[model samples]
Target: MDTTNSPSSTDTDDEPRWKIVGPGLLVAATGVGAADLIATLIAGSRYGYTLLWCAILGCIMKIVLVEGAGRWTLATGHTIFEGWSSLGRWTHWYFGPYIVIWGFVYGSAAMAGTGLALAALLGGLSVAWWGILSALLGLTLVWFGHYGLFEKVITAMVALMFVSMVTAAAIAVPNVPDLLRGLVPTIPDGSVVYLLSVAGGVGGTITVAAYGYWLREKGWNTPRFMRVMRIDNRMAYVITGIFVSATLIVGAELFHAADIAVSTGDQGMVDVAEVLRDRYGDIYGTLFLVGFWAAAMSSLLGVWHGVSLMFADFATELRGLPGDHPDAQAGGRYFRAYLLWLTFPPITIIFWGEPVWLILAYGVLGAVFMPFMAVTLLWLLNTSRVPDRWRNRWWTNVALALIALAFAALAVTEIQKAVSGVL
Candidate 1:
């Protein structure tokens, strides 16, 4: 498949090896979507830099999770799904419905997010229509595009997002004293929920589970590449840290004024873009929206490609196909079906309001997934599933245990909010 200009080639390209863009970069771009941006923005606007440490902590948590995923695949020569199946059939029972329902709802949400930024940047259509268009665009790319091409495009978008937000924050001139104070980790009254969101929500999703697949695609799937995988994972989250913290800095500097009211959710980013127009100039505002669009689109594309690859694998395994089955790879029949699954039907939700029940089910299922992933990884890596040489070290097990507990708490909180919203 189309392999020219693939970032994977950087391994020996003699190009300046700065960040070493690879599966790690893809996971980084995929993990930090619009929701993560809004969470940090809200935290900053409400409490200034007081929650900055949470962003750091969130990244550390994710690093552990992604490392575990990658390690399992390299050590066991099996996909994550295969590892889970060895545990028993219950995993299939839980994962089957969760992936299907989660993809449907998440597809609409992602399209709307990209649409929001697109409509703001270009004024010809409603956010919903723009969202539908974005879905189609994402579908086209992932459906026909090779992994190498996809990686290059994601790298460009991530660069735009990083530059736009960090540059905006720099122009705002952050208060060093306030920022320094934020590192002390004291939670103000009523800051519990926002703190939880920032600490746990930095950059995570089922896409973290897809890290291994990207590793295999990049030809990094062996014990020999363990050191490289660790570096790639660390650098990815380090980049994630900058993306999120720069957004928080933007919130703290631009939206902290008493006159500015920050909207919750991804729309809040659009609101900030308008503020940018007034505060900076048309250039800055347009830049900000373009950055936001890059972010939303990068994330949508990542999920479109990564998670669909995952679904393809899941389907292939269920059909008793070999691990090397063609239908499980990117652009294969199963993968294309999932890409279509993520694209077309969600357009109806974007057009007319769909029923709430399935969406709520999606919410509840999605909420529990972080913990599910964490706990399962803890089990898989600790037991005989992975080789003794590559099993979790003491520190790794502790980290995963703590992550599982933290995610369990966040899942419960998310479920409560989902249920309360319906009531």
Candidate 2:
């Protein structure tokens, strides 16, 4: 079973170590997809740097969550799904339907988002065609590439996103005074939606739970890899924090100063670009849009790979398969099945538009997943299933609890938004 411990770096090796940053980068990259960009840009346009604290808090929460997922894998040599299965049948029950519905809905949205970027880049192609092409590209890449290839591609994409976005922010030159005040952590009046959106949207989704799968893929399965995993996870989210913060800075400097109204959804970023063009000229706006595209595409690739992995795990587990049992890991039948599901099913939404009920179901399911993950990780890591020394620290527990409570509130507000539409 290849139980030999993987060799760690020697003390004398002073060279920059890229291997230390592994699946955590992939997780952070994938989790902080287009929706997160939209949320951050919106917050910047609406509240300027006032909600910058929420974005920072969101990054910290994700670090804790992803760290917990990675820690469980390294400590127990079990996948996150395996950890969840140990929680009992209810975990499966919730995850089973959620994966199915979430994949169907998210696939179309992700493809469309990717397509939007492609269409922007290539003016001739229709958005639908671009979306389909993007989906196929993701499917083909993951179908052929192993973990190392996937990680490399994602790392490059994250770098592209970071440079583009950070450069845009630099050109905008946000106010130091306002940015300083934003660090004070005060939510402005009547900003509940802004706060919840920032907190909830900071690079999170069902795919955050896939961190362990990626960890296993990275050959981090023993207690020895624990330190490396922590370093990897922390670095990934720190990058994510910077990307999000830079977006807030751009928002504060550009939109707040001009009193511009940012549109809703992913298009909000496009509007930000337009404002940048009007104010600073073409170069700044074009560069920001390029960065926006990079952010969206990185996320698309992440979802394409991560959620498919989760579904593949779920499918194999339901049939009583082992982790190394041929059909469970990446490139197995179950994995391809999900790739097909993610690529094909959501196309219907592109043509017909997402139904109100389906959107509602997706929102409801998504709102609870963070809490579900946090609570279950707490249970799994604390139990005898994991080594006592590797279990969560007191601060970890407190952070997880706060994450759960915060998501619970977000879930309630989401439900209210859903119900109000019906009434």
User: Model 1, range 325-349, lDDT digits (tens) per residue?
Assistant: 8998987998999898999878778
Structural similarity to truth (TM-score) of each candidate: 0.95, 0.94
Off by over 4 Å in 1: 1-19, 257-259
lDDT of 1 at 237: 85
CA lDDT, every prediction? 0.85, 0.81
Off by over 4 Å in 2: 1-17, 421-423
Q: Rate residue 360 of model 1 by lDDT.
A: 75
